[model samples]
Target: MAIDEVLADLKQKIDEKLPKGTTISSVEFEGPQLVMYTENPWSFADNGNIVRNLAKTLRTRIVVRPDPKVLVPPEESVNKIVETVPVDSAIANYHFDPDVGEVIIEAEKPGLVIGKHGETLREITKKIGWTPKVVRAPPISSRTVKNIREFMKTNHKERKEILKTVGRKIHRECTSKDQWVRVTSLGGCKEVGRSCFLLSTPESCVMIDCGVNVGSEEHMTPYLYVPEVSPFSKLDAVVITHAHLDHQGLLPLLYRYGFEGPVYCTPPTRDLMALLQLDYIDVASKEGGRPPYSSADVREVLKHSIVLDYEEVTDIAPDIKLTFHNAGHILGSAISHFHIGDGLHNVVFTGDFKYEKTRLFDPAVNKFPRVESVVMESTYGGVNALQPSLQDAEGHMQQVIKNTLQNKGIVLIPAFAVGRSQEVMIVLEDAIRKGLIDNVPVYLDGMIWEATAIHATYPEYLNNDLRKLIFQKGENPFLSECFRPVDSNELRQEIISKREPCVILATSGMMNAGPVMEYFKAFAEDERNTLVFVGYQADGTLGRRIQKGWKEIPLKTGKGTEMIHMNMNVEIIDGFSGHSDRRQLMEYIRKMKPRPERVFTEHGDERSCIDLATSIHKKNKMETRALTNLETIRLV
Candidate 1:
């Protein structure tokens, strides 16, 4: 049957199931949802279970919206919302999107706007004829979030059309019945960067994690030239596991190559992906390198994004149901679980997961309804890769900072702008509050400050302790007074020149670019200063070279290359990395509910990947393979 026939059958069934007084004006497909426009939306308002029952019976998500003809004017709707919602909700802004018949209310306290069991929201919708979408206003303002929200509102019509097109394609009739699933590693196999994979069935094709390697020019992007990945438009969907450049940097390149499918991820991941992609272009331009994709391509990606919360089962293709589980590697990092052919097979891809808990998030989820094949990362899966406990790592870090401050010297810590920066901030704040370390100035340089602001915006995604501190206690560690933002080059220079004992956190975690290099150049010759490594440093990066005890390093300068002597103290505090170590990886597999029949290891050095695969096969008596780029494996 054609897609129109399928939708027609669904609409007829829906009309029959609806309440007696409910009248359907139109039925439309919006992405994965079937939206019904009604003249009287309140007919079924007394019993919310009607929609749930319809959804279960149809085996698809359903959304009911008032017909546009019945909707109140934008101005009148805004006035009614303000009057209905309490003043203490701290409504920061109101945005009306007529295309979706939604009035977005950004407030500091979204619960108050929702009222008990969403009574207030129902009242506003019934009164104004617009669905209320409540969003929490970030305590720390985020320019990226604000820009994305504004762009979404302004382009709602275009976005709605895009969704409709995608919805038609997703719900299209499946032609083939030969049920088989195959996965191809386009990149991020026996390597730590450029993570990409292609999952294909007879009915649909999907790509996961289009990434780039910052440390390598020759092997930067995924194997897009592969025959299986060519004609990018053939892909039905693209799923991003996180906002990290290694997982999503090359996403915009898809849009540049004529791919118009929806990109699925969490809300924070969408915002952070935009921020990182724009910054990637700016950094490449400043460093005199050509960016692969233009800013316009990034904007296209934003318009096509479909944000999903964790554990929300969504259909991106006719044969696949995608569910995201917490990975605990970063804010919004997810382990993608694909249920294919209505449980004919299930594949779980662990994208750079941290099986152990951290200050920022809970440990990676090991439980799933069903899984047959597992593809996991082996970033720290080498046999000897054992890290210290979190408590010991924090203690060591605190002592190092304390000694550096006591000696009246500055401390430089190069951390990833997203996860590591926020984790370090929490640790430092706790140490200072407990008097374990001196209360010295902690300067946030480069994109760390902006990334920290984004972290503050999503406290609910953080660990339990941190969320309680922010939501209940009203004490956000990210807003600690000791952390200061360095926004100007002059301030950076002044901090470098001054002998004041302070702690500095800068971005470009591998020291390939950004403000960390400026501070490193200034502090390299100071014997009393300290440089710490709190995250993974890829090979060929300046950070890795320094870790190898390179006494003098040549660096690019305006006048040419110059050599700088290294005299500062260097510290490598283990256990702070977001990647799970070998022990944790093995333990995760052991603890997994309904153990997988086979496992594939990737996202590590060649030796690490091989070793992990071998160990898992030997210990669990399961088929295991360490795949390389362009290798295809048949799972079903």
Candidate 2:
């Protein structure tokens, strides 16, 4: 029976025995059963018998254990696994159930039976239709450490032979000595926006993260414009790093051009890109210009995506192995890793990464199997990009909010719809719950709320701490009752004009475009409201201009310049950035088990890449190449 029905049945029986004016204060699920606490005034005999009768009636085992916290599943009458896979020489013992599936292993050496990749056990389960678990065989007291060594030796030998067969098959399908694998970033070379990278191999071609140049162009176009359709026609996949437009805006245009392949991403990215692409179309339409692509085109693109897990290695082509790892930049953002040939020329591309753990996601994992070369980004490569500690950053944000609330003015945070918006919400929620700030309405005005919802769907991809905190403590920090998602324009205007102390988190953190611009234009002259920046503001963006002490900004409406005389405070918090800083990058390289022979740096300006290359060469005594777009470097 369902849990709700079981609870209802228990409630009905309890209410029949209780008198009027009595109340059941609590009903909780304890280990092995349900427990109900009441404010009744009587202690009746046969209470234990009544509870036993309730269990019988519900068809579920229930016991009133002393602690009331011991809940366990009811015992079954039969040994299910033995019925199918009988105790034979191949199997020492078997225990199986419908829910958890079957487990068969060797009594002496379970590790040897399972094989290194669990190939032996997994194959059995696949054939038998039951889940298999290899027992961790404990060492006998007589042998102790010696027994462990012997068992592991046997296990390694058996597992290696089994894996060798499987590896041979995989190798045959994914090796190309004559094939070419080259990635060129035509744009997004200097700054964080206009992210476009080209990947070409003999067997397949792909481009990951084709976004627009928000920092430079008045109207951003997809990076796919840089490559002709003939090159893209041979493409096998176009993987998006995340849903942020700079990472995913020009996806639909791929279909418009005539590229049709599986758009691989995590499930949350698939859902978020749907909403974001539609918004992109709407925004472009409102501007009375040629929109990038139609909504139907985006749907078509989404339909072809094959959502996979973080480390699932799948073949995009006959000779290409692709896997996604958590990048910790935004919800569903991934660092693409390619194991391309028999030589295992492993290549790791950090689409955008956060080396430090954040509220919702874990830091990027730097370990890989012999990474030949790394294509890294240096958005914050300049000496000025170094960030303060997380505590200091959060403290400044809290102070800004407190000061703005004291003045009874709204605080606007123009954050990116993905990572920045989520980080700000997490900090704000914690601050509010701890009574650090007054209870004020936190309005989510742009695509921020939708993005938050997407992040919630995939908690496993987040940091280990976040996963534990979410699952164990039952905390949904992003979906707190304090946040109000504003959708309608009328409601947004009403909230903005209320003259109350509140927080407004909008999209387009750069102030290049999106709802943040509208809020800034409305609140810039107030002198009471404060605009807090929680992310990097690229040069030429309104956020950057304001940060540089620009007194006035040219309005998009072309009316005139708007003077910012408002007491509007500007504060920047840096720990939330997704990229690793200079120190972190160097430390990561130093820790690699097998140091790379050659390191090529791209995704940053000419100066930053050269500086990084120079540093790596001087320190590690290795060849470091500062790569330029369209310039190909031969490996091997």
Candidate 3:
């Protein structure tokens, strides 16, 4: 069927289902959703089930919006909203988007803004004829989130058009009938960085991740020059599994290269991805290096983003239906599940998943409706790769901190801004509250503070224990008084000069750059001070070098290169890792529902990948392979 005819038929079906005398101004597609603009917005007030039943019949998501003519002016609507909502809601801001007829209401307490059973929201909508979308005002403000929201509001028209274009493309007819599925590893196959994969069927082509290898000077970007991914515009969509640089760092390059498709990710991932990309550019400029893509490219990527919640199934292309499941490695991290060609096959890609639970999130999801082929990460799949229990790890970390602090020395923990930083915060906060450690100042440098602010905005995405602590018990660990934000060189200098006992968390987890390098330089020669590694350090990174007992390190100085003697007490706590160890990786495969027929391992050292594949094949008696970069395999 033609596009126009299909839309007309859908409109007719909708019209027949709506109540009599109700008029729909127009029915339009808006990126995996059918938006129906109604002249009588109140028609849906008493008959909510009408739209629900229609969605069930159409087998697509439906959204109801007031017609442009029905919506009141922004000035008048703002007044109505202010008068209707309770004063105790502590509304922070109001943003009006006429393109979508939505008034975004940011408040300290969104529940109060929504009222009991959405009564206040309905009242505001009825008063102004604009839908009220309530969002929480993060306790700690995030500049990245603020900038993105403001940009979105200012460019509503352009964003709307982008969504419409994406919607039309997704709903277009598929002309191919030959059924086949293949996957190509453009990078991140017997290595841990620059992760990219191409999943292709006759009718659709999707890129799973486009990342960078921050540690390697020779190989920085994924193999976009490959014929399968060249001209980047041919990709139907790009799905990001997480916000780590190795997972989403190089995404803006696609926009720079003429790709105009939507990027799919969870809400937190979208925000964090923007933060890290912008930071990447800033770092490069400061370091006298050239950035591959500009900030304009990052904005383009954000404008074209379509955020999806966990388990919400959406059609990305004519032959592909995509769903996200929690990956437990980081906030907003997901395992991509693709249903292709009318259920001909299902593929699951576990992107940097942690099979065991952490303080920040639940364990990665293993159950799926159906999965015939699986692509998994083997970052910690070596034979001796077993981590201590979480309890032991926490106790060890606390004891180390105590010993350092009691001796009047600072503890420097080089952590990633996203997952490991936040995890350490929670652990430290709990320890302080329980009097397990002194209430010393915990300093947050680099992007750790900003990243935690983003975490505060999405408490629902956290683990159940943490969520309840935030929502029910009113104890948000991220907001503990012990934590301090270091925003200037003056404060950093003061902290180092004071010689006080404290714990400092700095970013650039691998110790390649960022504020952690400065702290490492300052504390490296102090035998009393301690350096902790709470996360993985990729090969070729400075952190990995230190892990391998490189005592004399050459670092750039103001005058010339200087060698720094590392005398600090260095500790590696394996249980704090976000990636699953060998045992957990095997357990994930063993517990996976409806066991897959074939498994491919990636995202690890060459030996680790090969070991994992060999172990899985021997233990489970299933076909397994460890893919190398640029290898292509046909599944069906």
Candidate 4:
């Protein structure tokens, strides 16, 4: 059936299902949800079966809001809300938005304000014609969260329009279904960055992880111009698996090019991506490079973005449903699972996943409810890419720090501010607590401090032990007294000049840009100093070049491209990486749940991707392939 025919039928069914005298002013889509604007909302909101039956008939989620004409005045609604709530809620602040017909309530304890079974919320809506949206205040005030909220508050009108426009596009009719699903590798194949996969069925088109390659100076972005992705209107949604620049950096460019659909991701992924996107723009400007998008473009992403927790089944495209599972790579990093065409295809994409638990998160969810084919990452898929045990790695790090501190030499660790920096902080804190390493000043540069604060805000997403340490015992490694934030370049340089034997963790993890480059320049000539890498360094990056034993490096500096000698000790701790090692990658496949029938590998160097693919094919006798960029695979 055509889209118009389907919607017409759906509307008729909804009308029949709703009780008599229930006035529906409008019907629209909010993502996959069917939202009805009604003058007589009490007739629908009060009756549970009305919505349940409508949802079953329509085969989608349903939401009903009071029409703007019937909405109570904001001031009047606010007074009643204050009176209806109890004192325990500690309602920090709230406001009413006539457009969405909801009262946004920010409280210290949102659950307390909401009451049991949402009885109070239903009462409020019935009495005052305002829906209540309760949000908990951050345990520690976060400027990023505050700004995101303020942006939403100020743009209610704009956001409402965006939602309506998106809703219409999402529910638009499709006339064809070939009954076959094909995936086009736009990028992140035969390479480790610029990860994008274009998934298309006759029913809809969706893209996953539209990112940029920060390691490249020329071709830094995914192939969004490919015919499979171009004329962007057909692009239904973008599902970001993680917030790494290599995973979501080019997302704003979609908005800049007039792709106004939604971007689906976890809540932490939303905020963290915004932080990195804006920082990328700032870094580009300072380096005299032109970024593809601007701050405003990233803001557009936040406005259109929809956040779903792990395992949330959301209908992103007409024939597709998306579920995100913990990838154990980073906070909010996910393994993207797609269930397409009512069992026609079930595909899983391991977006840079780790199979083992770390100090930060549980391992990637291995037992999905359903999967027919899987796309896996091969970042450490080579036979020789084995990592030492975490205990040994931590012991080595302690020894390195102890030796460096005794030698009165600085220890510079270049890390991704989001995941690696926080893990290293916890490792150092543990070493100190265990009396294994001496107390030394730990300085955080780049975005580490702000990122650490963001990590603290999402304790529930972390591993059980870490969550217990934080929410249960009220202990957070991020708040350690030894860690100090570095705010000024002058102060950073001053510390370098003072010949301080401190441990400094800064970005970028691969040393393509950021304060890590500055620290490397200042300390590179001193053999007493050490540079330790706790993360993957993409090929052709400064980190890779340094790791390959470059005695001399040509760097773009204030003096305009100077050549510097590297006499410092360079060390790499493979065990500290967020990615699983070769052994873990193989084990990940070996322990598969109800073993997939086919597999495809990507997101690594040519050798690793091919090696892993060959192993999977031979070991399990499963149909598998090592895909390259622009390769398209048809799965029945």
Candidate 5:
């Protein structure tokens, strides 16, 4: 049915189901939900089956809100909430969105605020006309979380309008019934950076991941200029798989252009990606050049964003239903599952998935209700991509640090701020506790510290062991006292000049930019100092070049490019990556609940993609193929 028809049908149903003497003022679509303004909102509280029957009949979520005039003042409601909710809940923030009649309550212990069986929430809703939406704030107070909340509160009116606009677009009627689906790779197919792909059918157009190629300074972005998603005028929706720069870095560019569709993602991903997007702009501005989009574009993206929890099925387009599964990579990272058409097709895109368990998170989810064609990342898919055992890798890491410390030289570990950095933190913390290495002050950069803070917010998403240590055991390795944050570059310089024997974990794991480069430039000439890599360094990157034994390389300086000698010891410990290696990759396919019919590989070097595809086809005989950018595949 068309959007107008759906709305009319819902209105008629509401009229038929509402109790006598109850009147509705208006009805509208708020994204995927149906919100109705009724004078008899009390009846909804009294009748349980009324809403149950309506929701089942409409096959869409519904919310019955009170008329505008019935709401109590915000200040009065705040006092009531404070008096009603227990102090143990530790309410972090509370505000009322007048436009939506929602009382947003953020607390450290959301369970306490919810009471037993959500009695507290219902009490608040019944007392005041405003609905209570209790959210569990991150255990660690994150500046990124604060910034997003403030933005929404400050521009509630604008955010409301944006949601209404998106709701209409999602419910738009389909114009065709062609039961064929195809995928077009815009970028990140044959190589690892600038990852993007267009999933299109006769009824809808969706992009799985839209990100830029930061390593390629030459082609440092995705092919957004193509006619299909160009100007992004015809795009229905965009689903983000993770918060890494390669997966969600170029999202603002969509808003900067003309794409006004909603970006579906998990809550943790929304916050983490916002943090990265803001940091990207800050880095670009510091380099004396403008980024592709401005802060306004980013704000627009946030306003248009609709967060869905893992396994919570949501409709993104007329024909596409989305479900997020835990992708054991980072906080809020998810494997994107799109159930398209009326069971006509199902596609599972493992966006940078890690099939094996890590200290930070559980392994990526392999079971699904249905999967026909699977798009998997092949970062470590080559024959030689086998990783050393975790025990061996940790031992080697400790030995490297031990050697550097014994030489009275500082050690620098370059890691991606999101996943690798946190994983290494656990390794280092555990080593120190076990007395595997001498105790040293482990320095953390701003990005690492902030990213760790984001991780602390949602402990439930982490691995079983880590989550137990955090929520149940009350012992978070990330909060270890030995860890010191390098708040500024001047502080970093001071630490180096002091020449103290310490370890530093910094960002841009590839040493592309950020605090990692600063530390690398300062320590590269020192033969005693060591640079350890615990993450993947893509091709065309400085880290890759150094790993390939580049004695010296030219780097951009304030005045001109200067050659930086690589005298410091550079070592790579292979098992600490968040992405699955060759062994884990094959095991993931082998253990899939219902194995996929066809597999396409991307997000790796050309050789890895081909090698992995060949192995899968030869072993499983699943009609696997290696894909490249701009390649199109039809699945019917």
Candidate 6:
């Protein structure tokens, strides 16, 4: 077909598939390539996947132009589609290098063309010609680790200066010279998880979210080994944002020290914490003595908890009012909003949030009259952490389970006692009811059964659609007949000993610590048994070691310690990650109305944190910082 015919055909095909309010403005031909430029390509953000899928169906390549000004090739066929995009007003600073057949586009805004893995360059090349290698005007010296380090120090110094200015403005309202308030992070300055902050005024001292680092065991102190002489204990309240271990794991240990204040969180957070702490205890017991804390201590911590509803703001102390908002990470998980002082200051702690909606939670709420400072989780700080769709995750999980059960082989699912375990059970139960699997016993050991009961009691905390399905439709996926809750240690041992082909779901998803170890020891030697991990496992943990395809595990059993040979199958389903990916995090930050003045990236690896900080500064022009453990930077 001629170029004009191709352009007309492409326009017609796109118009047919697209919903209302989209139209192609024109088409053009550049060299041998063809392009169909659209006037309204904002739909690409919402239906990009659909466009790509349609392209494949039509046996053509479709590239959504990121910029509207880029000229489009008109010769592209409707059926033999080349690419389409929005034309932006910006001019390309650098074009392709003809010597290497590389597309070297220079950028005034260098971040956009580089995207999350040079996606912008890839898109341009897919639509135009060869993959473009982006190059900018060279500096006097090449960019290196040394240069970047200097750049960061300079940036940090500048940020501190800016912060001092802001802090002075904030402190200007102090009525008394002796009584003043300043803000600073106790831990997690740059990264996401393990967010704890210290807010001090002459009349009040408050600490929020006593969290443990999930990334590394090299330095895993709950508060970076900060000594608690009296200042730490004098705090009015130690509030937890959610039940995720990174957020709530270390609260019990606070009671081990001299601190004896209320451990405040949601009611479901209380119940989930018990389940998590018990599992933590069980894991520590198997690994030998000196576990973090005992079940007794956890019980003590629970007694000190003051459960508050989402919108009901409760005064924890004379100077602090606390409220919980749906974080959308998991059931009962909350983004803590603190109204400090008498209309003095407000700070929000997003424990672990999901801004985008998911199968089990609502989107993160962003409504507050005042929010002076915000602490957020950065688990997906690295670009790679973004997730596939919920449907894809479920479908992938279904396939893994279905394949494992087909051979009548035992499928051992090592899941966290909290959210992941419950989700997997629901998926399995649905599959079984759908007659997708053979009649096989499905066992629920560890704290999962108890956790499910807690989940049942708190329907309002769950996603709106899920609650409606359970309450209105009367569908009991959690209480399915196939799910046999192992009530006692003896029952668990019996189920492990039984030679039945079944699906066993146990706690401590990482196998670092939980009942999963017992089952693993019993079945590790059997080739028919499959171990599936659905969450991130810390390094040096048993789960991480096993997932790396270790054939031998040194384990201490009831009889004694011994090195066990293993032939069990192992797999990791990565899409179920609750934390947002790097892409999602950036988008979330970009969308914040009246954007935050500063960004601290954390809850990720060193590389992830550094990369995230760079992105924040480059893309948003925000003063982003990444701090090491125990490092403190005064806001004033």
The whole-model lDDT of each prediction reads: 0.91, 0.65, 0.92, 0.86, 0.86, 0.63
**Estimated TM-score per prediction?**
0.99, 0.71, 0.98, 0.92, 0.95, 0.67
Off by over 4 Å in 4: 1-26, 38-57, 67-90, 115-128
Best by lDDT: 3
Better of 1 and 5 by TM-score: 1
Error of 1 at 82 (Å): 2.3
Question: Candidate 6, residues 1-636: lDDT per residue as tens digits?
Answer: 443565567667766876678555654332111234554444454455756666566433344432344323323311111132122312244333222233444432344555555455445554544334443322112222123223333444443343333222222222444534554555654444466666566555667677665545644554634543244567666777778776777778777766655667887787677767666667567667567777767765755555677886655554566778888777788878777667766766776777867666777776766675555667778766667776877787777777777766788988877777777777778778898776578888877777777666566677878778865785656767888888799988887777578888987677755678788888888887788877777666788888787887888667787897989788777766666777777877787654766766666667778888789789988787765655544432
Give the clashing pairs for model 3: none
lDDT of 1 at 160: 94
Best by TM-score: 1
Tens-digit lDDT string for candidate 1 (394-450): 999999999999898999999999999999999999999989999899999999988
> What are the runs in model 6 whose C-alpha is more than 4 Å off?
1-195, 212-218, 224-231, 278-288, 291-300, 317-319, 341-345, 558-561
Candidate 4 vs candidate 5: the TM-score winner is: 5
After superposition, candidate 3 runs with Cα above 4 Å error? 116-119
- Evaluated at residue 212, the lDDT of candidate 2 is 72
Clashing pairs in 5: 138-457
Error of 5 at 29 (Å): 1.4
Q: How many steric overlaps are in each model, in order? A: 0, 8, 0, 1, 1, 24
Q: Write the per-residue lDDT of candidate 5 for residues 1-636, one digit (tens) a residue.
A: 877788887798888977788778888888877888876565666565777798888777778888878888989888888888899889988888777778889998888888887778777777777878987687666899888888878988987887888788778888895788999998888788878999999988999888877777876787788787776968988899999878888998888778888898888899889888889889989988778888888898899888888898777888888999999988888988889888999999999988887888888999999999899999999999999887889899999999999999989998899989988999999999999888899999859988998888877788889877876777888888888988877888898788889999998888888888888888899999998989988877889999999988899999899899889998999999888999888888878878899999999889999999999988888889899787789987
Q: Which ten residues in a row are the worst by lDDT in model 6?
A: 77-86
Question: Model 1, which residues run further than 4 Å from truth?
Answer: none
lDDT of 4 by residue, 426-451 (tens): 99988888888778789999999888
- Model 4, residue 532: distance off in Å is 1.3
Worst 10 residues of 3 by lDDT: 39-48
